[model samples]
Target: MWIIFGILTLIMTLLNLYMYNAGKNYHIFMVLSLFLMALTLCDQYQMIASWSLAGDWSAIADVAPTLSMILWIFVIGSFVVNVIPLLLSYRKNR
Candidate 1:
């Protein structure tokens, strides 16, 4: 599973880079894909961490705080960075 997710992340990252350089409007898709990949990795990490803890996971909620934080931050940030501009421009253009 980890290997699969790692490969997926790599593929998405590569796709993002290619899309970026292709001079196409791909930021939205690229960011979404990257964010999803990141979240998937974070979830995988949490699963591993949970298994490692095994009924003794101290402060389970605290484990991999950064993972969730980073996931949501990137998700929301990407939306703000990409969508807001599109919206503003759309409104302005209209």
Candidate 2:
């Protein structure tokens, strides 16, 4: 999951950069996506730390309050924000 998020985040970040450079006025979505991507990276770090300390397969899977879910929410929300604005723009242009 982390790897998947990481790759998606990279792609989105690049797209965001392009959009911003193109003067699309989509700063909020860009910033939100960037933040979520950073959060995903942090979650990956937490997982690594937990695994290293536990040194046991079972304990690695038992860590509570994992931040993965929250990160997912942020990712999905960012996507929604990006899509909604584009949709609104499309409707207006039509």
lDDT of 1 by residue, 1-94 (tens): 6456545655655565565457556565556655666676676677857766686555555655665686566556544544544465577679
Candidate number of the best TM-score: 2
lDDT of each: 0.59, 0.65
Model 2 regions more than 4 Å off:
56-94
lDDT of model 1 at position 25: 66
Top candidate (lDDT): 2
What does candidate 1 score on TM? 0.43
Q: Residue 34 deviation, candidate 2, in Å?
A: 2.2
